[model samples]
Structure formats: C-alpha cells, structure tokens
Target: MPSNVRHLTSAHGDASFEACVVPYLDAAYNLARWLAHDDADAQDVVQESMLRAFRYFHSFHGGDARVWLLAIVRNTFYSLRAKTASDAAHETIDEETHVLVDEQPSPEARALISVDIEALQTALENLPHPLREAIVLRELEECSYKEIAAITGQKIGTVMSRLARARERLKTELSHCSTEACRHDVR
Candidate 1:
C-alpha cells in the first residue's frame, strides 16, 4: 500500500499498467478535456499524466487503474492550472470533437445535434470547476459515485451533492436555451 493512496492492486509493472491503464485513454482524455477546457491542452495534460503514471507505476498497487489514472489527470490539470493560472483561467474552450457524419444523417439531424452540442458545451463551460468535474465524471465518463469519490478524493456525499447541483444547473441551462430557441434561432 502506498503512503498517499489507498490500497491499489499489487501487480507486476509496466506490462500490467499497459494492460490496465491503456484501455482508459479515452476516459482520461475526456476528463482532461473537461478540466483543461481545451483539446490541445488536454492532450498535453494526458501525455504528462501518462508519463507521471508510468513513473509512479510501481506505487500503484493493483486496484481500479481508471480511478488512479484520472486522479493523476486531475492532479496534473491542477498543477498546470496553478502554473498558468492567468492563461488557463481565461482560455476559451475550443470545440474540436468531430461529429461523425459517416452515417449520412439528414441535414436536419445534423443541425439538431449541432444545436444540442453547442448548448451542452456552453452549459458545461459555465459550470464552476468542482461542479463541472463531478458532472463530467458521472455523466460523461459514467464513473460510479464510489469511483468518482476515489478519483476526486471527495466523500461520496460531496460527490452526490455536486452531481445534483450540476444536474440542476445543466437542466436549467438547457431548458432556457430550448425555450429561448423556440424551435429555431438557437445560439
């Protein structure tokens, strides 16, 4: 058991990490993207977090690797955030996740997806750091409350409260957008 973390699964080394952590790259990137609020910065953070995880892989006892990796991601994001507080705080989130049009959906379908994505992105952007993380982990990453608690180093109660608050905020935000949109003229 490491001094700082709870019991992680005791296992081999790099190969074990490769097996356990590699699968969660998307989840890590998603968390990083939400935290850094920029795809390129998120990629940088994930890259750094992966390196740190590899360096500290020995300390990782063999529990849930996803939780461990995301914790490192959160920590890395905070470290970078601290270093570039002014730049990071004011950085605009660039939406670059390409929507798959391979299915050849109708133009109307694409437009609806665009609008929903825009409003959701705007709402998520407006969320404070804590609430944003909770929602992103729970809603986007599909992490259990226990897992979220572990990754965030927060009690389950705190995680649940933040999720509830975040959900309310998102609901209000989306509703306002929908109503204001009035079947068209969406932002």
Candidate 2:
C-alpha cells in the first residue's frame, strides 16, 4: 500500500477509511471540477475535503465513504464560492462564445475517434450548471440517488426529481440537435 494509506490506517486506526475514502479521490475530484469549473479550484476543494475527512475520520460511523466525502466536498465548494462571490459575476462566460464549432480532425488520424462524441461533449458543456452537474453525477459518475443527495446536500427525493428533469431536458436538447443535423443534410 501507499504511504498515505499506511499513515491513515495507522494514525486513525481505521482500516475502512483508507480502503473506502482513498479510493474515491477520482470521483471527488470529478465532482469538485464540475462544480467549481476550474482545475485549481477543484484540486483545492478535494485537498481540503480530504484533510477534513482525515481529521474527522473517527467520527464516521460506517456509512458510505463516497457519499460522506462528497458531502464535505460539496460544503467546502459552496463555502469557497460564497467567499468569492464578488468575483463570481465577473468570471461568467458569454453564452454565444460557447457554441460548438465543428473542427476538422487532423489529417494524421481521422478514423480513431467519433465526431459525434465530441459534439455530444460540447453540447454537454453548453448545458446550464444545475443540469450539467446533475448529469455528471447521476449519469457519468453513476451515483445513486442517496449519494447524489449527500453530494448536493439535497434530499434523496429532490435528487431523484432533479435527475428525472435533467434527463428529459438532455433528451430534448439532443433530439433538437439531431433534427437540425437532418435538415442540414437535406439542404
């Protein structure tokens, strides 16, 4: 095992924390990145959350560590955002600038990757924060409703409701894209 895991296991005397919490680093980072919308902010959130979790490891009562850590991450992110509220309004990207431009694949390798996936990801990036976050957590992260609830600090029912609404909106958006593509083909 790694040194950090060894230290965590020995220092806290909690094997479960090392096993469960350490494994969730990628998921935690992904959530933070999606919420914060900046690589540095995401790293800061995850680091702070890990430190807090390590300090409070003993208080954890055998619940799912992913959900527990995610709760901490969510809280830390919102707190940081609140502290930086003055700068928030200034950093917003213009919507028109986010429109996807069809970039041709380089001459060297056109057959390896699908253009549709790139287009889909660009569309996903264009979604509003709430819908995008919901889709990332529920669909891409494969988080359960309970886990998503803990991460978002919402009730499980609310997470479920939001996920349902998000899926419907994504479906509508994708269908519209498909229709536009078909019309362009005919023309």
Q: Each candidate's TM vs. the true structure? A: 0.84, 0.71
- Candidate 2 TM-score over all chains jointly: 0.71
Q: Clashing residue pairs in candidate 2, if any?
A: none
**Number of backbone collisions per candidate:** 8, 0
Tens digits of lDDT, candidate 2, 10-111:
686667677879888888888777777666677788877877888888898987888888788878877878887563522333334334444686643443
Q: List candidate 1 stretches off by more than 4 Å.
A: 1-13, 87-93, 98-104, 183-187
Q: lDDT scores for all predictions? A: 0.82, 0.71
Candidate 2 wrong stretches, greater than 4 Å? 1-16, 86-114
lDDT of 1 at 130: 95
Best by TM-score: 1
Give the least accurate 10-residue stretch of model 2, judged by summed lDDT: 89-98
